[model samples]
Structures are given as C-alpha cells and as structure tokens.
Target: MKKIYLFLLALCWAGVSFGGDFVVIVSKDCPLASVSTTDLKRLYTGKLENIDGTSVSGTNLSMDNPAAVSFLSEIVGMATTDYKSFWLAQQIRGGSTAPAVKKSVSDMISYVKDNANAVGYVPKDAALDGVKAVEVK
Candidate 1:
C-alpha cells in the first residue's frame, strides 16, 4: 500500500511538471519586461487591447495540443470549453474577439517573431529564434 501511494504521488508530480513545461513568450522587441497574471488574463480574454498604451495582440495554440491545454489550465485559469464560451460571450456583447489560434507551436513562435506586439505560449524548450520569454507575475 505504501509503495502504491508513493507511485501515485510520483505520477501526479510528473503530470504537474510535464504540464508546466512551457513558457509565455513575446517578441524580443516588445515593450513590457514582465506581466502580471491579471494583465495577461485580460489581454488573452480580449478585455484589454493594449499594454502600456501600445496595441498588443494575443495568440493561442489549438486546444488539441497538450501545451495549449496546460497553458489554458494553468495560466489562463480556464478549460478549453470555458475559454471558448467566454470568448463567445464576449463576441456576443459586441466588443471582443478570441485570440488567433495557431495550428502548432512553431506557428505560434513565428507569429510572435513577426508581430512585435504579440504574446503567446509554447513548449519551454521550443526554439526561440526571434522571440523571448516574458516573466509572468
């Protein structure tokens, strides 16, 4: 029984570590050095249109990706279904749109590289050729 309990605890820890194996990234030239979680949530949910008076955009990976799922759950604080519904509600209220969804992590990185004001999350070890990870508060 003790061994089984230890194994389960280890399994849970592995899951948490695996899910956390990603980074929130932005263009290397982006204005902000770090972002509070509140600001990030606002930016992603479309409640915010700018950061430090500079127009900024958010990008999302398709929820089918484990990185995306983990990002949504841990950082965004929503499951895929809730995130979709929240976006739908925002759209219906006539003011916001969901973040652009990228097909893959590479695509997400490319987006951040090209869009100076864009923010996204990708696997921690993903090649960050033209982008940089921002500290999340």
Candidate 2:
C-alpha cells in the first residue's frame, strides 16, 4: 500500500511538471484582452502580423525551456527541432525574422512588460505582476 501511494505521488508530480498550462502574456497596456489559439499560432508562425490593429512583437523562451517546447509543439503546431529548422530556413531565405528569445521565464516576463507590442507565453504559475495574460481559446 505504501509503495502504491508513493508511485501515485510520483505520477502526480510528473503530471504537474509536464502539463502544458501555459498562458499568453503581453504588456498590461495592450488593448486586447484575449486571443484565439488559431490566431496565436498564426502570429507565432509569421503567417500574420498584428492582432486587431495593434502591432505585435512576439517573444520566445529559450529553445531548451520546457515551456518553450510546449508552446512550440502544442500552440505553434511544430516540434522544437522542426520549429528551429523552419526558422533557419526562413532566415536563410531572407524571410521574416524569428521572435526574440529570452533565456529564462524572468527574462521573458521582463521583455513582455517592457515592450507594449510584445506577446509571449509562460507557465500559468509564473508571477505576472506587470504583464497581462490573454485567454487562449
């Protein structure tokens, strides 16, 4: 019974760690309140620019960050490796530039807080004092 309880506990902890409950955050001054997942995917993939009339500058977390992986795979519809490859091809072809990447969650928050047009994502549990989260539908 004790072994079973411990195993369940470990499973729960793993779920908490890998679960993708990320929120799309932007500067508090941003006019929009929420955005759809489709729109978000478009914005991140460079297929669309600006959300509703507000120019959007997208920021990304480092490639190795789990949140980044989730955002890329779950939200952006691309694996991290494939995403990097796509961006590299775009860059080589003189297409639109990739979003700026921050090394940590704190750095991502700081960048979004400072840039009024910026949009980024962080884990739902992250402290978002200066930024506002846009509901992902």
Candidate 3:
C-alpha cells in the first residue's frame, strides 16, 4: 500500500515538472513579433500594458487547463498556487485584476481573434488559423 501511494505521489510530481509544450499567440495583425521572458512575466502579472509601443493584454486558460499548467511552470516560472496567490494579493492592494481566464482553447483562440491586443497561450499544436505564434525570446 505504501509503495502504491509513493508511486502515485511521484507520478503527480512528474506531471507538473514535465508538462507539455505551449505557444504564446496573438492576432496576426499585432505589430510585435516576439517577446522576452521578463516582459512576458510582467505582462501576465499586470505590470505591463504594452510591448514595443503596441498595447497588449494577456489572457490565460482556466486554472485547470494543462496548457495553463505548462505555461505557468515553463514560461512564467511560477507554481500554480503561487501565481494565484500573487494575483489575489494584487487585487487586495487595489491593483489591477488578474488577466481574464478563458474556459476552453476555442474560447481563448476566439478571444485573441476578436481582440487585436490580446495575447495568450495554448497547446503547441492547437489550431491557430486567425492567430499567429509569438516567439518567446
């Protein structure tokens, strides 16, 4: 029983540590072509509003999405709970609300398609017809 429990614990940790690839995306009309990790973090945390003179708004998938899990750990360099807590504190301090959350990949993609300033991430192979992948620098 103990061995089974231990194996399950290891499996969950491995899932978080070894999440799949994700790509940041924006509407094809966005002027910016790429973004730095530092700036990407700042944007998500609401410390930034524009990149290279173009106004930008960041969005995230709902907390449960695997792609969001990957984005937080890999690109944002934050654990899920820590990221949630940071946004909670930010709101308590009267700072901006956290980025909007889309409930599904289709919703996220549709949002970016409709909002030219929106930037978001999804599973690497997710359909990206009206959106263009933004290189992470």
Q: What's each prediction's TM-score?
A: 0.81, 0.83, 0.84
Residues 15-90, model 2: lDDT tens digits:
4333476778999999978787778888887877888898997789998888888888887889999999999999
TM-score of 3: 0.84
Residue 73 miss distance in model 2 (angstroms): 0.8
Residue 112, model 1: Cα distance from true site in angstroms: 0.8
lDDT tens readout by residue for model 1, 26-57:
89888877777778788888878787777888
**By TM-score, highest first, what's the ranking?**
3, 2, 1
Q: How would you encode candidate 3's per-residue C-alpha lDDT over 20-134 as one tens digit per residue?
A: 5788999988987989877888999999998999999999999899899888887678888999999999999999989999999999999998888999998888989799888
Best by lDDT: 3
Clashes of 3: 0
lDDT (CA) per prediction: 0.83, 0.85, 0.88
lDDT of predicted model 3: 0.88
State candidate 2's TM-score.
0.83
Clashes of each: 0, 0, 0
For model 1, the local distance difference test gives 0.83
Angstrom error of the Cα, residue 87, model 1: value is: 1.2
- How does residue 15 of candidate 1 score in lDDT? 47
